[model samples]
Target: MGDIFAEGVGIAGRSRTALAAFALGMSLVSSAMSFAVDDTPGIGAEMAVSSVAGYFLFWQVMATEGLLDGSRSRGAGFMAYAAVSLITSVAGLLGLVLLILPGLILMARWSLAGALVVARGSAVFAALGESWRLTRGFTWPIVGFFAAVCMAFAVLLLPLGIYAAVSDETANIGAAHYIVEFISNVASYGLSALISCGIVAIFALLVDRDERMASVFA
Candidate 1:
């Protein structure tokens, strides 16, 4: 926590500007992809665009994790993570849809998959398997940690939420309102980055703990 707060989480301080730009670009590209496929038929452009967008999101997550772990590799790393995103996402989503508890458990168990894949060049399935193994008996703890993080984030975002709430369904909104909304958006982005950093920190901490436990067993 101290290191992440002081030095710059998974995204190293020096390159955050580049990261923000990259995130912006990926979002725009994803939006364009959706627009391009808006009217496509069954199993068409929408699905393809969704897959691409999912890839970029996964790529960013793993890339940040890798950066925090001091991995110098790029491009190919992102592509690899993107490919693995499909499998992890389906597994997680299925768990969530069929039974919420199962979904939450699966998500918690698989949360470190991105970090594992990024840090080790492991296959997607291998990474997911490792996460499941490492997280054993820790699922509830993981969920509680994220819930606390979200609560803290919500506190920071309260003002924005209030403003948005008050302005809801109003026509002829003004420049001041737009400025408020912009501020809100920037705050949201900062919080999001912090959460990502938190995830990296959690992965590192837990992995270290796992190692120590294994040593005791040995």
Candidate 2:
């Protein structure tokens, strides 16, 4: 987990320029969405949107950075990644609603599907299956990683949350609000990118380990 975290941070640092552009674009899009609604859709919805966009942009980054096997099949791989991601997200949400543990397990298990889709040109279900198989022994560790991530996210956003609450109570709608919102959105998107990097790192490590084991057995 520590290695994955370190690798993820390294990836983000090395590709900061591209990642910053992606994060800025996402922040603008999220701001537009909020403006279109005439209200912020609460932090939950914002986080969901950020997560989706982050993975999509991260996949593109991986392709352009030569980290993926199917870089030439970007369009097809993107479509498959989107489809599988939607299903996985919905199913994971359902699992969460049923019981928190199952949802976490499902999410952790299928987390690598997007990486597989873009990196290995896997079909939707195939990617999900491969992710499930790869994550078999790492479920608890992944869950722990996710928990740590969530805590860090909450810490990062806590100031924004407090400010939002205070503003709501005081009806303080002004330039400051917009400024804070923009900053918060950027931070959210940046965190999402980091999470995507970590997942990619995990996917690479798991795939490599699996191959080494297969060779040993063969």
Candidate 3:
């Protein structure tokens, strides 16, 4: 597990450019969603549809530009995106059972698997099988890694929370609420972007490790 984490960290450090691009794209998407929600409180359904569409489009770009060695075939990119989306959707549905524990695990595992499939030009089913096989003996370790990462993220948020609280307490006059809200929103956005980027790095690491192991055994 320590080795896995170390490898992941090293890969992430080396692939900083790709990870930064991905993270920036994610931040833009999230900011757009926030704006949409703020502008139209009752447009949740529209927002959901828009978000899904945007997610797929962005993911297609990521597949072509970042993952597939610069391949930009539209058909292949869309197919890869759809295949991954379908797998994750099915996993989400299945997660409903066992109170969704298994489903969440599958979702996280398949994220890496999807990247591998697209980047390596593997079939969807084959990728799923490989992911399951590779993750077989490391389930608990992966889970623990994710949990620790999430906890670390939460701890990072504490300072932001405190800043918001302090801003709120010190605010005065008519602009107090707006100022506090703006500050809090900005802090939240920044923190969310950082955490999201970390998760993407983690995904990249998992994909790379799985591929290396697969090659070694093959």
Candidate 4:
């Protein structure tokens, strides 16, 4: 787990440029959408946009390891990833609404679906099934990782959260608000990149282990 997380950090570092572009573009869109919706209905829009952004980011991360090296098409991989991720996110969100533990467990189990889609060109259900199989024994560890990641994200986002709250209370919607929000969005996306890369690392580790075990048995 430690090694996988470290590798993910390294991947994020190496792909910082693409990450920056993604962050900037998405943040601008998010801010604009928030302004349009006055921040209420925008919540759902934000979630939808974020889901799509995550799929693109995951694909970019996997591309660093040669996602396009074979005959697999990018369009197909992306569509598969998008479908599976949407399903996972909806299920996880529903679980969270009912009981948070189920949501976390569901997320941990389906975390690798994105990687499987890009790496093996898996279909939506196939990738989800394979991810569940691969993550069976590692669910708790992944949940721990998720906890650590959420803490880090919260810490990084503290400035923006504080500023937003203060702005709301003081009615200070000025130029500085935009500046802070943009910076905060960048930081959030940076963390998202790290999390996506971490998922890729976990996928690679599990696939490698499976291959080694198969060889041993054969």
Candidate 5:
């Protein structure tokens, strides 16, 4: 059996390397969208949209950085990466429509494709293959990590959510609600960025461990 806790510990130890980059990227996207949505009724939603964009961007940067390891990528083949994601998403969606279990399994197995692309600079299909290979016997762990992330977020946000719900009809509701929402938003984004870093760290750790195991058995 794999030492799941050890994998988590290793990821936590390396989170600092990727956290700042993820946060900065997300912040920039959020701020830029904030300006665009100024005085808009749906500003919060707009900001959320931008933050999501930033999140994806941050992961790309993390993958690029992880693969190169402090070196610069002339170009990590962005078109290829995007194409890979689109293709996989479509297939995953179809699988989901056909069967929930298979779809989820496919999603988890292909989760590392982008990172593999960064690491190997290979074609999208090749990267997918690499991710699938590296994740063998580790799919459950990968799903568990995501579940852990979700649980962490849910635990943290439950109180705020309850407060918001309870206060919805009280006087000064707008002000208090905004306060709670602001805190909730910040907490959510911060947690999300942390999880993204953990993902990069895990990808790095997994590939490294697999390589070490291969060399040992060879």
Candidate 6:
């Protein structure tokens, strides 16, 4: 009925505006971790640990203030959502053999549901239930929106991908050739993080609108 995606965009914008620093910090941490992994094997493990810490820290900031509803209950809610995501990711990875689409759908839905859990101060199951309910009549629209976004992102990254391919072919580079590759990877990681944050914001807006509409009706 309502323009759920438009609502998600607005909420995401506000969330991003409020938590820009956190997002930037997380992106930098993730990028550095990726760079470290490419450069050194031993240090890569340490960087990976640091990246996880940074991720949770960023989630704390976004969940506490960006959601505007769960400042006190943020810790529990965040943990719950994180648990759900971990399970989802693991299942998706392991079960990709049986049915790819189910795994992929679970992955996508869990992400939005995790955000919903934080924003709504609900349990992970409840967040998922809400997501299902909100998406009931708008599945195709949501899918189309995601496809469009993905296509746009692929187009935007075409030049970078081309350059990477060209470099690999022309230089015949090995993994030991880390400098340029690391730099390029970091740049790509940052760009991807920014775009991902934008997309997540859009979904957050949709979740917020669904909550508001349900409240009004009730």
Estimate the TM-score for candidate 5. Answer: 0.63
Q: Compared with the true structure, what per-residue lDDT tens digits does model 4 show for residues 1-218?
A: 67778777787787788788788888888888868886668978887788777777777777776543366555657777778878988998898799988988999999988788877788889989989999998998888777788789878898688997799689898989878887888788778877887887786677656867999999
Best by TM-score: 4
Question: In model 4, what is the error at residue 141, expressed in angstroms?
Answer: 2.0
Better of 2 and 5 by lDDT: 2
Which number leads on lDDT?
4
**Local error of candidate 5 at residue 28 (angstroms):** 7.6
**CA shift of 199, model 3, Å:** 8.1
Report backbone clashes per prediction: 1, 0, 1, 0, 0, 4
Would you list the clashing residue pairs of candidate 2? none
Q: Which ten residues in a row have the lowest lDDT in candidate 5?
A: 63-72
Q: How well is each residue in 1-218 modelled by candidate 6, as lDDT tens digits?
A: 13545654554455454345444554455456655666476356644554454345446535533544645453546566666567655865665567755654554554466556555567877877766665565555554555454565566566656765777778955563445444444444444444345435545556656667889999
In order of appearance, the predictions have TM-scores of 0.59, 0.82, 0.54, 0.84, 0.63, 0.58
In order, candidate lDDTs are 0.59, 0.77, 0.53, 0.80, 0.63, 0.54
Task: Put down candidate 1 lDDT per residue, 62-111, tens digits, no spaces.
Answer: 46454334553544455556656666668767976897567667767887
Task: Indicate the residue-level lDDT of 185 in model 3.
Answer: 45
* Per-residue alpha-carbon lDDT of candidate 3 for residues 1-218, written as tens digits (9 for 90 to 100): 46556655554555455445444554455445654666465356444553354344434433533545455343454465457667676765677465646755775565455555545656777777766665666676665655565576567556656665676577732455444444444444444334333334444556655657889999
Global lDDT of model 6:
0.54
Decoy 4 TM-score against native: 0.84
Runs in model 1 lying further than 4 Å from the true structure: 1-72, 83-103, 158-162, 165-168, 208-218
- Candidate 3: clashing pairs of residues: 95-100
- For the record, the alpha-carbon RMSD of candidate 3 to the native fold, in angstroms, is 6.2
